[model samples]
Structures are given as C-alpha cells and as structure tokens.
Target: MGARRRVREVRPTDGPLLEVEDLRTYFETRRGLVKAVDGVSFELIAGRTLAIVGESGSGKTVLSRSVMGLLPQRNVTREGRVRFAGLDLVGAPEHELRELWGDQIAMVFQDPVTSLNPVVRIGRQITESLRHHVGMSRSEARAAATALLRSVGIAEPEQRLRWYPHQFSGGMCQRIVIASAIACGPQLLLADEPTTGLDVTVAAQILDLLQRLQHERQMSMILVSHDLGLVAGRSDDIIVMYAGKVVEKAPTATLLSDTRMPYTEALLRSAPRLTDGSHRRLPTIPGAPPDPSDYPAGCRFASRCAYAQPRCAEEEPPLRPGAVPEHTYACWYPVGTPHGAEALELNRAGGAVG
Candidate 1:
C-alpha cells in the first residue's frame, strides 16, 4: 500500500476532536520528583488552533511532550488520559502509537537543528516518513518530498532536497521540518514553538504558513509557546499554564478581554504591545515560578500575585467556570471583580481577607 492506501480520517464529531483529562507527567530526579505537567485538561475541535502559553519553566514543553509520548520513559511517570480521535493514547501499545505518529499525528519540534538528522539529506528526511507510513515507492516518495518543500514555500525545492540540514539557514530548515511533519497529512499537529529561534519577520512567515496549511488541510493544531503576543490573534482557544498547572483557559477573544486569573492578567500586562510608546518600559511579572519539586501547598501563583490573600496561601482554588460560558480560571480573587479589589486592599492593609 502506498499513497493509495487510505488512512482513516477523523471527522468533526459532536464531541471534541481531542480531549485531555487531568494529565500529569512527573519525572524522578536526584533532587526530588518534578511535576512537569500537573493535572492539565483541555479540548480541541477539528480544524482549530489551541495555544498553550506560559513562561519558560511553566511546563508548556513538558505538557506537549507528554501528549505526544515523546518523553523518555526511564525515569518518568505519566498519569491520566489523552484521548485523540476516540483513541486513548496513554494506554495505546507502542506499535499502535508508532503507526499513528506520522500518518495520523505529527509534531514540528522547537528547534530544527536538533530535531533533524545532520548527516541525512533533506530529501531522505522528508521521504522517510512518506515511504514508511504512506508506503510510497522510492520515486513516488522523492516526488512527494519535492512537492512538500514547494508547499512550504521553499525555493529550488528539487535542488534543496539534496542538501543537508546544516547547509540551509535556520528559517529554511524550519520549513523543511514543517514539510516533513505534514507529509502524511496527519489529523493533529503539535507545533512546539516552531518559530523559536527565527527573527521577527521569519517567525511571522512561519506562523502564517502554518495557519494557511492548517486551514487548507483542516488539521487540528496545538501551538506551544512562551510569547503571548505570538498566539494572541492566531489561536481559537488559549490555555495559560503556571508552575505545571493550567491557571486559565478560554476562547482567545474572551480571555483577552475578560481575563480573570491574576497570573493571566499579569502575563497580558507583560507582553509588549504595538500601541505602547517606544520609550515605555514593559512590565515584568515579579518573582520566579515556584520550584516544581516542592510546589507551594496552596495556589501556585500566590507568591507572585499582588491580590493574593491568606486564603490563597491556605487553599488552592479549583478550576471553575467564569462569568462567560466556556471560560474557566483557578482564581479565588479574580481580576476586575469586587472581591479582587477588596483582597488587594486587605493585602496592603496587612489584614487577612480569608
């Protein structure tokens, strides 16, 4: 079976295209247990883009890696369920996962240089997945690789395929990686900071290309990033993570306008805005994220939040619905609310609100 072999298509259903339920990925280290991804849950619809945004140590990468089953299993323990297209990926056999990897699910890693094989030619790199997953013949795979390169807007597709990863610039290498990821037309795509090392212009081009390709193929995508501005307008839904847990989640527009979580509000304030004066200093979130190995007993973001109260330090708030439907946040003193204002005042007055 070659490209003629029809892979099962995952159509839009009454339920979500992907459902993650309380996923926890923990790693055992010499220091202690590191809770990389702690009790995170979200959903993605068919042909929609879900953006996971957080700071460097906020577990965004770990969450994505756990979902894709890319983490090393030696010292790792993964709990909870990751249901994709009605299949439970966490319990799926190795062979089953392998079969779905390129044909039904694929990932574009953060760095192309580290992800690609330095010794292998670009053509072989792209064709390998096609030949294996799609069962394409040698000539057919070669032609497909060329077309894939062209689809990603790479120049001299035929000639470029003969070159090695080191021969191309960083942006071009990233495009090649994207080509390889979509070679089999996977139903789901995980782009882990796909534009990480590129310049602003190149990053926009890459993001635009990803958007265009996702729309054309009707592919569901998870864009993992640390920059809020990058995903502000690009994604349909947004999940804000802090210290390995999701602090807030909502439709992009709703989250931007009606933010509730203090951590999320701080993140929005920290992002560089085009409307800001050139000389204006950008606001920065105070305090580093809590150590994952020994996280605080209560709310993870309490130490850094100005509105935090004694209750925040004593008990963690559960993720619950906000004023808007489908918007959820784990915050007792939600921003822009009377309770939040009173909490801040109490905090400044050296009084325990709770």
Candidate 2:
C-alpha cells in the first residue's frame, strides 16, 4: 500500500506510439525517498508487443504504475515524460486521462480477485466501461459484454453474467478481467504478469487469447512479467530491467540467440527447461537490488555484476547500442562474443558467475 505521488511530466515526443524518456518515480517513505524508477527510457511502436522482464522489486511494477498514472497524489514525485499518441502524460489532467484510460489504453492486473468488484455482477462490471467510455446504452453494453465473454472463452456467458467474483475459478476470473480490458477496444493494453498464479494450461490459454485479440484489433501491448518463456513466445521485443534501469533491450529472437547483457544471459539460463543436463546447476544472479534510498553511486548492479571492476564501482556506464544496432545494454563491458568467453572463464574460476 504505497501512496500515489503528484509530479510533473517532462520531455514530450512524437513518432513512436509510446515514448518514455528519463522517467523517474520516487516514493516518500519514513526512511527516505525511494527512487523506484530512475532514468528509464524506451519506445514502443503501434501494434507491437514489448515485454518488460525483471526480477521482483526491480521497479517493473512501479514503471507500469507511473505510466498508468496510478501513483498517489501525496508524497510521490515523478519526473520525465511519458508520451503516448503525441500527448505528454506526466502532468496530464485527470479528466483527460480518464477519457483515455479505457478507450485508448487499458490494464489487466495479475490478480483477478482484487481487480473485480465482489458486489457487482460480472456482467455489469465488464459492461460499465463501455457505457462510461463509449457512450453505449444499457442494453447495448450488456449485449457487447456477453459477446466479449464468449470471445474470451468463458462458458455460458449469459448465466455467468449474473454471478459474482466468488463463483468463478481463478482462470475464469482472469478471463473476465481480460474481457473487461478489451471491452473498450483500446489501442494499448498494459498487462502486469497476467498469467501469474494460474495453472500452466490456464496461463497458456490467457496468453493465446491476448495474441488473438491483439492481432484482430491491431493493438499494442506492454507485458510486464518475470517469465522468460512467456515473453520469448509472445513478445516481439524484450526489455530487461535491473535495479530500476534497463540493462538490455532487443528483438526477442535476437536476445534469446545472442544476449548482449550479463543480466539477460543470467535470466535466460535460470529459466526452467525439460531437457536433462546432469550436474548443471540452475544459474542465478547473486544478491538483491540495493535499497532505492541508498543505491550505490556507480552501477546499481555493480555489487552483483560478475564483470564489475574497480571502475564499475566508481563510475556508472552509459547505455550504448550493441553490435546488432537496435539492441542496447548499459554496461562498460557488454557480455557475449570475443570478450565474453574470457569473462565466463574468469567468473568460473572465481565462482561468482551465474
């Protein structure tokens, strides 16, 4: 339960469908200000899926919250620009954001229980957005809601419409959330770990539904999740974040085949596979993210990076474009290729590498 912050947006842009430049979000706590997202920047094209992958507490959720304008108005402070469709969102009026939220951009949460209202009928909850945002009448919204439920694969849509959140299974509830998110025919959808806490089959179904919807609607998506496999399968591009900053960003195929960042490589290695490889221990990046209030001066990940040198502790590296051109990593010594093997050998000798 964090308080939302009111801050000004800076740096508006054009060209890309969504552009985030030097975005910073800080929370006021008793200890100090928590700089959850500091100087993160990226772009998403229309109708393309950008998967944001990171470990827990890496500011993945915070960035999404900032984009959605969900942060509280109290002690939180936000700087930088979040421009979508040529409009700056940093200090956008609430009424303007409300008009866009359901019609232009929608969000699907990981947990269905908290997202849906218990007292309202599932039908009303899904249809309400259409009525408010699209100006659909009661009867029209209900019909549209029923069609949406069926489209999302919910069984017996008519009967289920009358039921409350308590009656549905986790998967069913998630489907309802998806239905609601799509009810307004939005152009951009922000799904925060949409498949978390569900059975593998159900999770796959949810992802499949999203892909189909995106294709049919020509919708763009910002998928926030830790599951590398899901991102690899569903996303066109991947953005790897660590300690409130992007370490690597590239096309998914490029990233999976040739990860240019040590952190991204570690994440790929840590993924569970069905293959049998004896004595090959699961790789893991050692140490947790530094407390935002007391982040290390140089690289936020320097304390855990295997390639860290004395300079790494003293100076932060700039995020530069990699060999592939579009792929970028923020490291003085980007991993992979000629220098990577020697680095891996050194790490093996010291037993500090993932």
Candidate 3:
C-alpha cells in the first residue's frame, strides 16, 4: 500500500504579524473584470520591513488599500485571506476593524496634501483618532497630539498644531501624517511612498525619521515604492510585482546581488545608478506591462521578456524558493548574475528548466 500523504500543519497562530495568502482584488469595470491584484502573497514579520516594489498600475496601491479596508464596496471584490494578529481582515466586522485600525495599524499615503484635510486643524485630526480609538478626553488628546508633532521632528509643535493642512509645506504635511500614523504606536505601519512629493533632501530626512521610529518602536512596516534603490536600502525582504502578481521575492542583498526573475533583473538594470557614467541611452525594460483585463496565460511578462520561449506562453510557473528558503521567484527561465553565482550558473550553463 502507498504511504499516507503527509498532512501539512494548519498553524495560523504561528504566522507572522501579517500574512497575505493568495490575495486577489478584482474591479468590475464597464469593459470587463480587471484583476488588479491576482494571487499575490507575502508575509510581514514583526519588527521587520517588507518593500513591495513595482511600477504604477502593478496593483501595489490596490493591495495596500485592500488590506486597510479602504476600497469602495460598490464595485470592488476582495478574496483570500489577510491574517493580521490572528484576525481575518477580509471579512472582519466593521466596528471591530475600525477599533483595530488606528491603534493596531495605520497608513501614511503617497500624497500628504491630498490625504490631509485642508479645513481641519492638524491637532484636531491627530486628536480625533486618539479620542475615537483610545477614549482620551479632548484635553488629553490635544496634549498627545502636540507631543506627537514634536516626536516627528516638527518645530514649534504647539503653534503648528493650530494651523490648517494647507498652511504647511508638502514636507511638513507629510510629517504631520507620519506623526498621526504613529500616535497610537501601532504595531504595523503601512507607508505607501510616504515621501512621494517631497524634494530629494526632504525625502531622505523623512526616510531617516521613519527608520529611526521603526527601530525605536520595533514596528513592522510594509513600504510600497517604485524606487528600487529605496527598497534595496531599507527593506529586509523585497517583493517585485508585475501585472498584479509577484514575480520574485528575496532577501534584499540576494535580490540585489543576484536577481533571478527576468522582470526583477530588468527593473534593476533600468534603475539609474551613481556609478553609471554619461551615456545617451539608459537601460530600460522593452515593453509596457500587460493590461489587467487581458493578461497573458503563461507568464504576465512573456511579451516583454528577453528570454521568452514557446513554453513561456504555454505554462504558468508557481512561486517557489530559489536555491534556499528565503529567496523565491516565479519564472521558468530566470536570468543569471554577471559573475558566476549558483542561480546564475544553473540558468546559464545547463538546460535545467527544460
């Protein structure tokens, strides 16, 4: 008789702070169903950072919105599990989720000006969450708000708290947003390009502040950015998304030094490096990503992939570990390193995938 199949242990309790399992979000558009987030999955451990790197329309923003329960309910559909601190966010009750929202998790969006209310005082906005979530009295909330502003490196916190959103510069508004996000000391922080509109110098300062805060609070963060350099420097784990799916995920050093997936490699090659000398043409990915409504069957990147084979258009590959457990990629024909590496030698010297 054949041996009994091994039963995989179902241990949701042992999962990380947030575990996104086969999550998908679809939009019912007039043209057709747009699978904005198609079966993307990753885990964010406590006190660590996971950077979701992708180009625009790659479902990076949508995925973050779905987790935060911010999407419009009329035409949006979400599937699969988002287990956070043992609670299922996808189907959790609204009131309970609201209670958990600010204290357990909070978000700092890409654009601070758009996110902040122009008519409202910064102090009121910050204290509102404190009053609602922590049941603080108005005076106590105001005091806390002032402290938060100071904590995020805002000068003249007392005076700044009375000003409206529009009175502050873009960088100041972003700092206000960050201050409010950390008011309750949330265990999870979702920063979606939190430095998006700020100048380069200000952006660096903001990132430095965030990293310092994370270290002090030991908070888990999911940083969504289009900048590969940002991810390479800040994240412990890197997940590369293309056409609403994760093509590769690996430790930061491994992914940067020896990217396996073609899409990931292309993204790295296209990034501007300080080392690159003056050149007329910069390296770039050849084609645009597929339209969500009509993604190719086998590989979403096959159309743009430099090493596309007949099989690439015929079969989809499951995301699995590369060489070891922390490094994973989804491609039949991944790329190789410039110098000899294990993953590189495997792909270049042998016909392993065939």
Candidate 4:
C-alpha cells in the first residue's frame, strides 16, 4: 500500500486525470434513438474544474451521467472511451465500476430531495461510503461524518446527523448530500446542478463550498449547469453544448472574450447580467432546440443561428482547433470571423433575430 501511494505521488501533475474521447450516449426510445450525448470529447487536468453549460435539453446532465456510467442498462447505449486514472470506464465491468464509484469517483446529483433517503438518518447517508470504502469502524465513521457535515457548513453537526432528511431545509440537505459525496475523497467529482432549487445566497455559498473542497482535496471536478453566470467565474474551462454535441470549448476567459459559435454567442447574449437595468428586456434565442430523436444531417444549430449560411444547412462542421491554443469550435461561419459578421448583417436586414 505504501509503494502504491509512493507511485501516485511521483506521477506527473500535468497528466490528465480524466480523458473522454468521442463519447456518444444514445437511448433506444419507443419513438426512435434519442441521441442525448453525441460525439463529445474533452479532458481534465488534475485538480482543475471543467464546466458544461447549455440549455435544458442540450444534454449536459446526460453527459455527466454518461461519464460516471450511471445510466440504466435497459435501453441505454454508451460508446467511446472514458479514461479515469488511466482506466477505461465505458466497457468496464459492473464490479470494476462499483469499486470506482464513491471511492475514486463520486457525484452530487441535481436534486437533494430525491438523492437523500427520506427514511434514513443523515449520519448513515454520510458515513455509508466512509465505512464501506475506508473500512472505518462505527465510531470512527460517526466522527468522520460529523467532521464532514461541519466542513460543509452544517451547524450542530452531531445533532443534525440523527435527524431525518425530511427534517432539514433544502440548503441543509444539499450540504449533507455534498458531505456524502466527498466522504471518500474521490479523485473526480461530477456535480450536476449542485445549487439547483437553492436560493441565491445559499447557491453562492454552495458554489463556494464546492470550490473550497476541490482546492483542499486537489480533486478534478466536472460542474454541470444551465446558468452561464454561475460557470463564467468558477470554472477553469467551459464547454458549450447544443443538440447533444459540443459547439464551442475554450478556456473561460478566451471563450468569453473571443466568442465563437453563433449558438454559444446567443446563449451568452440571452443570459441576464447584473449590469442590465431592471426594466430592460431580456434577450432570448429565437426558435426551440432541435429534437434529438431525428437529428438534422447538417449542422444541428444552423436553423437558429444568425450567421448560418447555405453551407451550414448542407454540411455538418467538424470540431477543429481554433487559432488560439486549447480552443475548438464546430461552426461553418464562426462568430468573430468576417463571413460571420457579414452573415449577421444580412440576417438582421432581413428581419431575422441577430
């Protein structure tokens, strides 16, 4: 055990803790094939955070679930490589994935209410992983669970542990859920809408807690959210998804500054900013997201994009490296390019949303 720990310590920090390659997750629905996460790929360096942002139906949640191999087996078809600590997760056996879950990888689900067992006490929820994975005795697990709750900002940790999930507020329950997720000090944490259903102040606190925990544990995290404002400042990198594919990906600053992909630009423009006047109308992206059951042969976002050209509606654009390093976008007429500007001008003159 000491030798194994020594090897991990000697490993280079530059190595990717998680590498996803051409991941595709489809569901065989009664209507048709639902391509929830289609041909998406990304990598995360050790101890960094990657934020997946998109509209509700853009499949950010599904992508995160696919990464953890946490989908139902009945109609789900997941393809491609998910390498975590150099282990391929896509085709790994159930037992192998079970060992990885909660110990090496953990998830904080979208809703805390449904995630926590209503009948179970808070202490059991937090200590289950600790006792099972770390083999801690009952007393040791109890003490560790108390510390975990305290670290997550839950007051009266010892007293609260004995209470049922129904007894706590949403914020407190969410904090307890987080405590359970971090119990084993997982190397990677997938946080799907960690602050969902939380008030603004509590949401901010939750985000701060997550960031603080990530830093202290040096764990890689994949944060999924629909709000652009939430991710802009928090994540090291951002990936924008549309129609089950990554339309734009870049460092947080680069993507915000040198904005590319018309769809991504629309999302940014639509997000309400603090600087806007109270009465100012909120901008919205025109047209609905495309259906995933029967995907378009051309670029999926072309129908709603102001800069889309004939080429965009005829041929799909491949995700390629941009002029800037570590940036990739899938678009025929990328925003910030001359053709894109011209197309936007023409579309606006033609009474299209621009």
Cα misplacement distance, residue 268 of candidate 3 (Å): 0.9
Top-down lDDT ranking: 1, 4, 2, 3
True-structure lDDT of candidate 3: 0.84
Greater lDDT among 2 and 4 belongs to: 4
Q: For candidate 4, list the clashing residue pairs, or say none.
A: none
Model 3 lDDT at residue 94 = 84
Task: Report residue 153 deviation for candidate 2 (angstroms).
Answer: 0.6
Q: Could you give candidate 3's per-residue lDDT for residues 255-339 as a string of tens digits?
A: 9886889888878888777787877366677778888998989988887776666677899978978876899998877777342
Model 2, position 276: C-alpha lDDT score: 48
What is the C-alpha lDDT profile of model 1 across 33-145, one tens digit per residue? 99999999998988899999999989999999899888896999999999988888997788888888977889999998888999999999999888887778899988999
| Stretches > 4 Å off in candidate 2 | 1-14, 346-354
Q: lDDT of model 2 at residue 224?
A: 98
Model 1, residue 90: displacement in angstroms?
A: 0.8
Write down the TM-score of every candidate.
0.95, 0.93, 0.90, 0.95
Give the CA lDDT, 0 to 100, for residue 192 in model 4: 96
Error of 3 at 119 (Å): 0.5
State candidate 3's TM-score: 0.90
lDDT of each: 0.90, 0.86, 0.84, 0.88
- Separately for all candidates shown, the number of backbone clashes (residues 3 or more apart, or on different chains) is 0, 4, 0, 0
Residue pairs clashing, model 1: none
RMSD, one per candidate, in order: 2.4, 5.6, 8.5, 2.6
Q: Which ten residues in a row are the worst by lDDT in model 3?
A: 1-10
